[model samples]
Target chain A: MAALNIKKGSSSHSAYDLRDFHSQAERSHTLALIVDNEAGVLARVIGLFSGRGYNIDSLTVAETDHKGHRSRITIVTRGTEAVIEQIKAQLGRIVPVHEVHDLTVESAAVERELALFKVVGGGDKRVEALRLADIFRANVVDSTLESFVFEITGTSEKIDAFAELMRPLGLADVARTGVAALSRGA
Target chain B: MSRTMTGAKMVVQALKDQGVEVVFGYPGGAVLPIYDEIFQQNDIRHVLVRHEQAAVHMAEGYARSTGKPGVVLVTSGPGATNAVTGMVDALMDSIPIVVFTGQVPTFMIGTDGFQEADTVGITRPCTKHNWLAKDTDRLAGIIHEAFHVATSGRPGPVLIDIPKDVQFATGTYTEPRQARVDHYKPRLKGDIEAITRLVELMESAERPIFYTGGGVINSGPGASQLLRELVDATGFPITSTLMGLGAYPASGKSWLGMLGMHGLYEANLAMHGCDLMIAIGARFDDRITGRVSDFSPDSTKAQIDIDASSINKIVHVDLPILGDVGHVLEDLLMIWKSRGRKTNRAALAGWWKQIDAWKEVKCLSYAPSETVIKPQYALERLEALTKGRDRYVTTEVGQHQMWAAQFLGFEAPNRWMTSGGLGTMGYGFPASIGVQIAHPESLVINIAGEASFLMNMQEIGTAMQFRAPVKQFILNNERLGMVRQWQDLLHGGRYSQSWSESLPDFVKLAEAFGAKGIQCSDPAQLDDAIMEMIEYDGPVIFDCLVEKHENCFPMIPSGKPHNEMLLAADAEAFKSGAALV
Candidate 1:
């Protein structure tokens, strides 16, 4: 039935694509990079994105191989598929970057982020905050007479839900370490 | 196996080891030590310029003309800052140049010391790569690496900032052979499966066109030769970008001239009407692909480039072969021949018939003026006079540059140099000087507009000192013709700040600089004036006054597609926006 709709044309190129090229949906992608642990390498990577008008939702970097002087940077960015591909290619062109792997498509990756939420309240709001924190498996890292600081580690979505629950319960301040991701299996 | 020497001496030594014969630079306070080393050395020659910017431009001209990496040395602060424009210009055009800056003492780097600037930080985005040598022991190794990075894979400018203290300190001198450059090896040869697939596509491409660019020249003369051979073997039409003009001879049977915004009528029409588009060593820059979504909508595209990032960056291609242009063409040619060199000859003949009909438009034609020289007429005369000589041409950016690209016929690679990517004004005069310096006997010319000629007219002094017999052929249109043309067409003729008023008598200025100058406005006297300029043994500036309102035609308006080009006949109608109706 699908073959009946096929139309012959002068051009040999086909419009059928695995991913629709015409669709302009913005998507989130997590990319892992291995780069030389040298001075100004981070600046070069960040500058490329900023210079080219690409957006970074979250970014985290640390030296993974101390002996070899190699650092791993995990970046979560949002763009259309074509823009994402360009971002990855541009990242790979940086001199110190050795590898850029899009973990979003390469594997069923595990993503985690650590965040701290400080809730300041004096009455029912304080109790409600504690109850929600206990349900989400968040530990009270610091406490006072009227305030409590909860530390939570989870996927970005889970943490977002937890933060939403705390917002109505007198969420005062929040700090998040950007996402870090790794592949699931060998 | 290594000898210890001051870092300044190592800087000079590393340049020699890298086979750099000339250094275009200006001496400064922070660079006195290195200048002293340059003074002590006889193996290398340094050409001093009046300003730091001209030095870099001169080096770019030398590099582009000779196929060797140009070298530059300057001081920190203002010196490094002045060089930023040329560095970015070279970066945009993929010209291989190594710029070295002398910095303040290490301890005073960030303390607002005299003549201090964060050279690495300011040039990070513009340069291919850069380094600030903090250790004297690593200076030579880093210098060698800078040269390697500048010339390798998709050649571009690179910089290294050497502190004054580091230059004074002693270090182990490392030979270029001893430098560790193992990490940065770009892929040179294409994958066999992809090459075979491309050959299959080539065999069946009825309306195929080869769109080549500057990468062919950067890959060396052999790549250009291979390109010509491939074009001949396949019997396909070829067109080039502005930077790739000389890669294929304009006189070739299959040549369609240059294609882009200001391209020939038939070449652009062929691009729009082609079934297969084979891009060799060319990026699909927005200037080449106006309205990208509608650009060659039906073509099966294939791109061959050294930089992997350039593939699928703009227009996605069906086949992306990541390799050097030379190697890929060599493989493509061999496999194509092994398969009996098949082609869709019947369909190609039809395509040629269409192209020939379009060529009948004669888009480059203009009415020859008797009073004032038309810019096009001037360039055509210049071309007729210097067609077959050992001539090198550079141009300042404007309508005159496009006219030169249209009228000048380049027979071989490396004979044409212009600021294609950056569209820089004031590039041609010093560039012509550098080319003259390198090839002392070649007939070098800087095609200029009157407005752009004044931007770097100071280079005449440099030419006087060096005795470089470069010719400056200025089309004195008395206006910024391109800006005024755009204003007339797109902005309702409110020509603001486009007039070249209060301009100097260029002939008097040239004579004042101890060089010969000739001024001519009559169409009949153009050939004689050009002859006088060419025959002079010293630098000559020919200010040829031209028609003020003349515009370059066959233009695809900024947002329009290739098929909607405005030819010379449609210029007036299009300007009135009647063509849209």
Candidate 2:
């Protein structure tokens, strides 16, 4: 019975420093992991992070690229040096997980997280939020209450750009899953 | 993995593994399948609350009563929306709760189907994490992840919206997988350099003080016992905020009394004069710090907590130890152990001498007249009676609430349940009902002021329906005590109709609800009233008509500290000696 492939150690060293993780909003990283499709696997992964007081900025899971027998997970988190290593090691321990890597950790990787941003504005600002949404290739899901909910998917940086544009235009709230990624080409 | 299981079955099994005993919920269209499977099961006890909101609050009460996370379940649209208030309440207080709401079929998700609303979308801002499960295979994992998110990282509420189609779908699911969080880590390890420095400072400071908060207990009980050690060693006087009520047993030496709006004057003064303030797990909330700029300005503050954001968020810290309180205290204790240390009581002797004099003067002044009953006297008896006996006591929101919290010297964590952060007015009855349900074997009491008693007086019938042996003690002053007290203190007693209209016989109301009721007036009648409640098989009420114009003293008068209290309940210097002009 190959229950766990990733093993925590007698001296399990974590990836990042515990302090100043959340405080670094700009430097904070969100990584989405892609893994083999299996049950109870996600729980094992989340339990590892939460059992300790590690925070997840955003998380989303879905079955993408079914031909490869895989699923995509977008996770937003913050940490430093030793903390990042611990996260990868723990994910690899799950039975159904084939690999675990932070899409934002290395230069070769590309990361993307989806956000449905809701903004409330009137007059000129409403026109501005709409024009910016068009430029970002976002779809409007709902409107009224002097607001619009725009559904957009791209790299977290792109989403941030869109949100930043909407900020002056009346960005009320944003709901996003940190990031999800897959290697380019076969 | 098993082939015979459906997704809903696997979820039920997973909740059992997570050690969930009580589940508060209401059933609706989308969640019928889960309820069907639940009906056939025997392990988890399901409570049917009157509304979806009540289910969430009941879960919150259960969580507060027990030190574990509480679970609430509801169905699509309105049912899920009904939980919004409870969810926000839990979020504000940093309580651990997992809310499960049923959703419409996956095929009908976006086509405006029956009872369909984006449960996950609605809850995104308020929850720590949320899930929209279309695939049944991930059901167990989602539940597990929801629990992990809610209980971990500053503790909060999480929501999982399960579509009906997914629940009925077949899937081979095992247990939830535990994943590691690479970032947003908790500081279990303290800075050795900072900790030792504070310990050395504690050893020498002439007027050092120890102030603690709810964070101490959150760090765990073993950590709290260290308070006795530090105080015994340094002889520093101990004071606390409203939320830090039970960090220590009330009747101990070196205890300066509570500090804040309703705190003892000496404790507030001592806080100001102390050269060093050792604060663990407490934020300098405006209620505690008063006019922040003036609060203990001369003292060097040492702040410790698990949340890093809280480090410099409140009062500026000279020494900020960002880590779990339990871990930090244990490390300090280890360092203290190697020093061959013994408690030094010299620093406390003079302070205790001053406090003792203050206590005597207070007792002489506030002594109840032959005719009127003192509200504090009732609480004093309550404190004496419940000693060592484990009980759950909740209070309606008002002056009596503060009085109970101030006087109790609570011996355990979670023993006192009231809306501390939210301060909900009508939370008492329902909260008491929830507590009683959680601890069926333990006696539950709801201490209510005259006005706070009316917030959910309707629940007396609910208590009767369960034949729940819960007691309600009404401190009847015929007015909203706290509001009137504020008006008296700050508004020149303009008394803006905060007082109640002519009273109803609460005894009759209790009788109407099929429960026993008693009226109490004398201190001697206290034991008999409480005993009569113990004898009753169901809900009971104790009405003690107290003095109409009484005030809670040893007052810290809003922004003052340590020695600046009104000094006693009836300090003559605070009064104008001449008769009304």
> lDDT by residue for model 1 over B317-385, one digit each (tens)?
777777899999999999999999999999999999999999999989998878888999999999999
CAPRI-style grade of the A/B interface in model 1: acceptable
Assess candidate 2 and give its TM-score to the true structure. Answer: 0.72
Q: What overall lDDT goes with each candidate model?
A: 0.89, 0.71
Candidate 2 per-residue lDDT, tens place, B192-225, comes to 7677767766666666778887777656566668
TM-scores for every predicted model: 0.96, 0.72
Error of 2 at B539 (Å): 1.8
Native contact share for candidate 2: 0.00
Error of 2 at B375 (Å): 1.9
For model 1 the local lDDT of residue A42 reads 93
Residues forming the 10-long window of minimal summed lDDT in candidate 1 chain B: B572-581
**Model 2 chain A: which ten-residue window has the lowest total lDDT?**
A1-10
What local lDDT does model 2 show for residue A52? Answer: 52
